[model samples]
Target: MIDRRHFLQSAAALGAAAFVPLALAQPYPSRPVRIIVPASPGTAVDITTRFVAEALSRSLKTPVVVDNRAGAGGLIGTDAVAKVAGDGYTLLFAGVPHLTTRWFTDNPVTFDPVKDFVPIARVSSSALGIVVKAESPHKTLGDLIAAMKRKPGEITFSSGGAGSTSHLCSVMLNDLTRTRARHIPYKGNGPAVTDVIAGQVDFTCQGAPSVVPMIKAGKLRGLAVTSAGRWGEIPDVPTTAQAGVADYLVASWIGALAPVSTPAPVVERLSEELVRIAQSPEFKAFCASQSMYVDIADRRQFLGQLPKEDAHWKRIAQLSKES
Candidate 1:
């Protein structure tokens, strides 16, 4: 038989352990939570993250604030969040560039992305669009490639920012088509798009979230989707691969992550709310209106995808280093 003192001590410890989660669950949001967005105000990732923060605030009856820390190709902001304490109060709402099918050694990394954070939810995905001036000479992907072949580096392309989805996708486009298009990295997609419209840059590839409306208004001409398949919003447009640049596919995605070592229960609770918000009809309508798609990946699935993305970027970075 166990001694009375030992038995009592054991019982007390178990009781306290059980009560920790209960006490934490009692009141989740006693104050406002901060969400760190790794981009500027107008990009698709920032827009989507703001929407999620709104929904999260309403659902949790708490204040969810978005803090934009845009610079150094998203690395500056990402590192900020990674260094935060493992408290549920700080979250990083980021895109594919920060964490995706890429590797650090092959690409560029300011931090050890794989170890710094834990995945919570994969909230959404946005396809890229091939955009050119409304009065451009190239009417299709083939036309652009043919022209590029005629004069390497003569064709200039703009991107949202250096090392962004726009930049990576454009480089991938060149890699696939065996042509060269000089890169013009702007501070944000808006400026780049403006320059393209003014005929300063030859073309740009960015997420549909920003270009769809421009394409609709005839301010910009959309040539092809930078996705594997066609876009539902712009059915008439063909994929870059389908249009001639075979194997051309690129997209932007957003996810929510908390610091590693945060209590599993807290992470799971937040994740549950994310899933609920994602499935809401209002959220779906908002995404559709923006020409984006909602893709649900639970914690397990989301975490599993991180390494694959890291590897992909690592290879890209390495190649970039070589060239």
Candidate 2:
């Protein structure tokens, strides 16, 4: 009895209406997610990322894997994440180097560190330790500073490499104290700390995880930690300020980030899971064992700190150029 054209239109409308709910009900992360650690395996960043990935996999009910992309000071892995789709399937396990690598490298960076990424959550942060061989004559941080002043360019310091957190922390120390110590860049923190222990270099600033065990084992002496408060694991070591250096605080942090094009809902979901993982007792204990502390920040809070972090790194870069 009805017109044929009108009947066909009604049927099409009914079919379209039925499909919308099914599409909307589809869950995010239907497949495995991979977190790319822009550093070699066994590094602190890689270890932390792996821990987070495991927890995330359990929380999201999907596989979460860590892929190490170590090269060119983390530029390779970072750039790879920047170029990937924003479907939350791929993410970056990033740190301060994410912001400072471009400043230190002469090579052209393909992605904008600030503009190309979105902060999901901040996992943890730790202060670096200024260490020397246990048998070194520089007994304290002040003593080391005095020695640098006394010899100027003669006191050599080693670092993981140019633009590393260790390098930047030492650079900041030199700039703040107005001392000139020759920098010996190594291929990695292991070699740099090794040379310190070998007495080939005067001293080096390194993250706690890399140097704490050495300090405890009498292989290295902790002069000062670059934090406002003393690290719990090594309470005997004073902070930089307490050690008589002011305005010389530097802490390295690791966090999760995705491409800027990622949808807001996906970002929110990931952020929630990360924040939860970061706050759990198990995660806190794990961080403490590594001489790091849980520093959980949500999406908005994490994004808010990037500007200041970027500016701080920029200033460090300028100081490096001047020196």
Candidate 3:
């Protein structure tokens, strides 16, 4: 029913309407982006998150700053990010602790870790090592395990806190070996390692970087690392499998995440930039220097793997409760 002129006008209007959304939409990362690190400064999470932020600042063409929100085992900052707008302005630099936080805390978590955040990219990870005081009578992992088997709950282990990766490492070890060890939760990794050095506890499954120096200084002895293979820094140390228990690998990983329901376009942009940063040579060099590795997972893989990891931790929590 339309005339030629009317038809032409309608076509032009349709073209303009299609262009409007694209023109009005602000380009992603128009402003500074904040990375919320839910741990104290100088912690592994904080250090790696800062590296990722610096690299993102370069690639995103905007200032990417790290905001350390240390409390509740990284729950405070992580919860803040979860509750914020999903505009990609705020993000969380999450670690393994983020997964087990709910299990550790007495208060209900304010946000669902899996459902409340969009996985962006994995940053870096380190291997945990079993370390005892240099003067401990046990010389090898087998000797320690034999003693644990003989004593069962008598062999005590310290961790950064309950439900930390360090604690979980010992749990996984115990689970594999079918042995029980007493858990002594400390305020932080530093104190836990300090106590171990003083022989206040038996041993600790702590990150290599935290205990490597002590190992080098003859303060602590490295028995086994929790990686599939020997870590570069301590090549002399055997892996958990090589040490005794086979098929045991528990890596301490950190990654990036944004609030759930973030725009797909923004999430894509952030994920792309972060993956690039994680894979860059500069970052790899930094990780190597720190005895870490660039373990990257893209958005799809990260999200897909979350459910499995969540379930795994949940089972561990349930088992811990049962025992």
Candidate 4:
């Protein structure tokens, strides 16, 4: 029933609509894509970034490389990538602190955590554990809390660095228990944890992936986990809330992000690939080996949670000062 001219016009519109997705996928990354890991080369972020990059490289049919830029508690690397061309080829392997750390600092950073970037996907999240040297006097988390309560502001703890997630964890612990603890900032968790093992600092919080082995070996004593529920990775470990401090939980998650101006279709494609990457059996095993859990969500959910994280940043910053 359609005339030739009308059929041609309809076909033209349908073809144009189809061309958008086609163009979006048009052999993207005709060259190498750089995934920026904004931390030391051997840290959890670095290790997982490498794994995801390898899987993504094979899936995307492009050689995706990881660039480790470490400094200023990950700010240096974030800033570096923020200025790169908005093409999909350049992306950041960002940690959760991308939202939290800024409020704690007085210094003005050049990077806009939200506006300057687009979230591709939330790859994974892990809990932190408060640990001390195996030979310490604080036999239990309750004892540590009692000691702090009795001498408010006297107990001391160490963190990976100023404004690091470890530091925020210490701040959160102080707020929850209504105690005061002195903070000692170090270069990274490895160094701060070294001091804990050496009894240089009283205690500190570290990610489960790195601390579980030490706890198992009896080198470190885990007092409380920073997640809401107990993790099977350390069956004997209790969550901070379960350890008598109500409503205590902190997590560190890594995600892929691109410049905000990148086209939505491009970002959607990237997110789909990320979800696939997370769903792969190999990636699941990889996460289990590290005791990491995927927080995998599409863009809308990620964007919705950004505001909640922003509010949490303010609370932690205020608590850091109070502690």
Best by TM-score: 2
Choose 3 or 4, whichever is better by lDDT.
3
TM-score of 2: 0.92
Which one wins by lDDT: 2 or 4? 2
List the candidates' TM-scores in order: 0.86, 0.92, 0.90, 0.89
* Candidate 1 Cα errors over 4 Å, as ranges: 1-26, 100-110, 321-323
Pairs with steric clashes in candidate 4: none
lDDT (tens digit, per residue) of candidate 1 on 217-274: 8888888997776777778888877787776767677889888877787788899999
Candidate 4 versus the native: TM-score? 0.89
Return the candidate ranking by TM-score, descending.
2, 3, 4, 1
**Model 1: worst 10 consecutive residues (lDDT sum):** 99-108
Question: Residue 147's C-alpha lDDT in candidate 1?
Answer: 90
Q: Between prediction 2 and prediction 3, which has the larger lDDT?
A: 2
Off by over 4 Å in 3: 1-24
Backbone clashes in candidate 1 total 20
Candidate 2 clash pair list: none
* Model 2 lDDT tens row, 148-187: 8999889999988788898889889889888989889887
Ranking the candidates on lDDT from highest down gives: 2, 3, 4, 1
Error of 2 at 85 (Å): 0.7
Residues forming the 10-long window of minimal summed lDDT in candidate 4? 99-108
lDDT of 4 by residue, 1-323 (tens): 77999999999999999999988676666788899888887677888899999988998889999999887787878888889878888899977667766665566798889878888888788888999899999988999999888877677899877888889988888887788889998877888888889998889998876688888899999998988777677778888877888888888888888888777877888888888998888888887877777778777777777667768776787778765
Tally clashes: model 4.
Answer: 0
TM-score of 1: 0.86
